[model samples]
Target: MADVEEMLDQAREMPYGEARSILLEQALKAAAHDRELAFEVRLELTEAYQYGAEPAKSFATFSRSVAEYDADPGRWSDWHTYSLLWQFKWIASDMRRFPEIPLQRAYDALEEMERRYTQAGYGSHAIHTQRTYVAEHIGDRAAADEWFHRWQTTPRDDMSDCEGCDPSGKVWHLAWMGRDEEAIELAAPVVAGHLTCHVQPQGILSNLLLPYVRTGRLEAAAAAHLRAYRLVQGDANYVDDFGDHMEFCALTGNETRGLEILQRELPLLDRSPTPSDRMHFAGCAALLLRRLEDLGHGGLTVRRDGSDVPLDRLRAELESDARDLAARFDARNGTGEQTRRLEARLAAEPLVEHLPLTPHARRVAIPVTQPVAPPPPPAPPSCSTWPRRPGGAATSTPPSPRGSVTTPSAARRTGGARTRSGWRPSWKASRRRPCGCGSARPSCTGRRATRCGGRSRSAGSACSPRTWLWWRRPTGGCSRTATRAGAAARCPAWPRPTRGPAGPRKRSPRSRARRRARCCHCWPSCRSTSPSRWRRPARPGRR
Candidate 1:
């Protein structure tokens, strides 16, 4: 018989989280007092929250176990009895968070368990189970199957009865690895056989549903998932209710419900004392969100105020709460990366846009017809031949020149002008001339320009030089010389002034210097400037 006091002593030396499993088992195996096992039991239940966001609490527990065994290895003889249970719990919890633990660590854990059992001699069944697990985890399906066969054939104790539960577990592993047919075959018997067994069968059955889903037997998958759901409550063994339920919902395309459950469960689980617990919950939440998005559904959902809001909205609300909590908590002594990570996770939720405005929500009136712009004036008629002035020297009463125009108002009429009010004879010429200071000189003062079309009492006063050169009539009192002066004053273009000496050209040294720097800031186009000076600063107001 195992020594109960020695086992409790073994547990008392361990950290509560690690010690709890062994202590509780020892309490049962030895019928030890309640006070001795209570502490470890509580610690075991809270282990997940204690290891928040960590990959596994088993690693820490295993590390502690190794240290304790190193001092005296025999203390673990009975402890190894619970090795499979602890390892399974560890692996389940670990996988929920860090699915990618290094292959070597897994191999070592399996090898270590094998070595311990080989030394113990009576642990061959447990050894086979663990070996199969390791082999499967490392992608050795054939080896895993061989070990599973070995587990089936190996001799039994009362502890070995639990080994059948492992086949259901194997089904999940096979399904995950894409060997669905084999997984289903292995799971078929247990699905029917083990439901009546003494051991709580939810863990393995839930695991088997994955294979059924993967194999495309949706009806079978749904049946198994619902069965597992009913089987997990108040179990003698472990139950990942939220995670299993999530898998069930996701595979069946009940995404909306899956997300709703996740949003609800995540917070309640985070309050668990073990860090490992928090990681498990967080990892599940993350995985569910990721899976929903993968399946083309939006992530989780939540109830806000009175309505069902998307997870994104709920997360935003939480993030605002986190800032207030952070300030209130005096974070220096409280949870470290965990609080920060939780806040960050809450903040990472995508921003949600509210629903479209309803008719009742609107307070302002909108115009029915967009305000129409006033219709533009009709355009002038374009002509291929030069316009003729009536009763002029050109072709009628007299003969002048082809390019010359009549008075400005008469010129406008022949150009076939159109006006906003109505067509007018002088409108075309009146519209074409610049009325402001910044008009371009050459184009406006060329041989093409017509004389101002309004009737004029004066000679050249009413007509510019361009008009005299191009006009047909010279009735204005203003002299033609004054018109020439106006053109010369306004423009310094080509064809030199016809009647007077040219004006002196004034220049500014400052202006010349400034003009040279114009393209200094523009590279490539102004290659004369050095490349380094391409970004030269503007000289105060000069640009």
Candidate 2:
């Protein structure tokens, strides 16, 4: 037994293909020693094969394990038998590509598992949960509801300690019941915390996204879709979840990105995906392409390696694949329920178009007892209220005082100035400080001047004429005018103009002649010299 366990552990540490081979070899060796040990080893081998995408091999191995256990039931415990039956039921149902067991066989297996659980005095929550799922899949709403209630009310002590399993199952049941709003409410916290197992996160979040979208909760739907997408991307083991991710992408205007993912994953489908996986991927591809067709891109094209393939052709191919897979499932399962559902879902009519923009639940508003506060008083009219100046330029005015406002033009016309104390006559007219250029100085002639050589002006002095000139000129700095006309009339910085020489000196005749001679040597066009003569001679020895 220990040797079998050790071999299984070692197999787990290897890649799926290698692990499946090792486990199969170990199971054969263990069969020679003990039937019980052989059964355990084969169980591990079955999972390895499944993970490696060899569903046929996995089903055969699992069947052998079950037969070995049945030959001598005393060798295996009830718990082991129950677990085996539970797993077998799911595997059988998922055999959509090439089913080896009928749907009735899966249901019978579930019934046997339930009997084993009851015989062992254990609650049948897991059994009931699986029953609910099967019922829902077959569109047996009443049976599904009854099983859901059974699962919900049953004690969970005997159920596996998978943290996400219970909530994810409940969410699925609620969503199928058309109670999507309730399902989303329950799933929001789980998705937010990123609590997920191999199976639950993809199932829970993907199911939640549909509700979110239907209820105008696009942001939440997008977030859930992204989380679900990241969970399955690059991991072929989770291809079962890929269809749900693609469906969300199509509904949420992410068809382009979804199409890229589909193209990338298409090659993997040919590499021996399970029947369920093949059906799912093909059905989702068909549905998405159908939606694209309905959106007016009837001749949509998929580009690969500079080659373009019509989307309709791709859709037709996928639909054919899905139908073929469904036919195979129906052949083995002896029931076309799931296949029929798949065909119905992938029909040309758009399912998303029928979804409501909001949830059916009405929001209830809570009443408050506190009195509402009054709104603040209107603001005083701003300087913007003043008329434009005669030149069509906006006049600048200071912010209005607490009780009174002053317009620039009005202040100028009234010959009054606003001061900290209040409105006052303009510095008593005569006593007002002279302009920075000096009251005795003449007005600017609008000509350029030499650099200042006067005494350094005080830092607080008014703006200089150069500053004012720059402020007033179109291409100069400080395009905005002063807030007050009186201030605009004065230099912001009062720097006195220097009396230095103001213009460039005239060049001497000899200097002018030399410049012309230099120019003639540089360019033959200046003196009409021959091109060869105009060129400077190379250094004597270098030539």
Per-residue CA lDDT of model 1 for 54-169, tens digit only, reads 23444554454445445755544454435433444354334323324444555565566556546556456666766666555444567877987787788764334354565665
lDDT of each: 0.45, 0.58
Q: Estimate each model's TM-score.
A: 0.39, 0.58
The most accurate candidate by TM-score is 2
lDDT per residue for candidate 2 within 1-543, as digits (tens), equals 667677777777777764567666765687667766677777777777666667676767777876787787887887677667656544644542346556776767677767766776667777777788777766678998998888778777644436675788788788768898888877866676657565667668877877777777776776677777777676666565677767765665656656777777766666645767778888888888887776666666766445787889988988898888777766755567668867776863433433322355232222324578999986533223322334665644322111121222223444765444222333222122123232211222232332222334432343233221110111111212222233224422222234548755555544432232221011112222323322222333533
- Pick the lDDT winner: 2
TM-score of 2: 0.58
CA lDDT of 452 in candidate 2? 26
Which parts of model 1 have CA positions greater than 4 angstroms off?
Answer: 1-106, 138-161, 177-182, 193-199, 213-219, 231-241, 268-543
RMSD of each: 24.4, 19.4
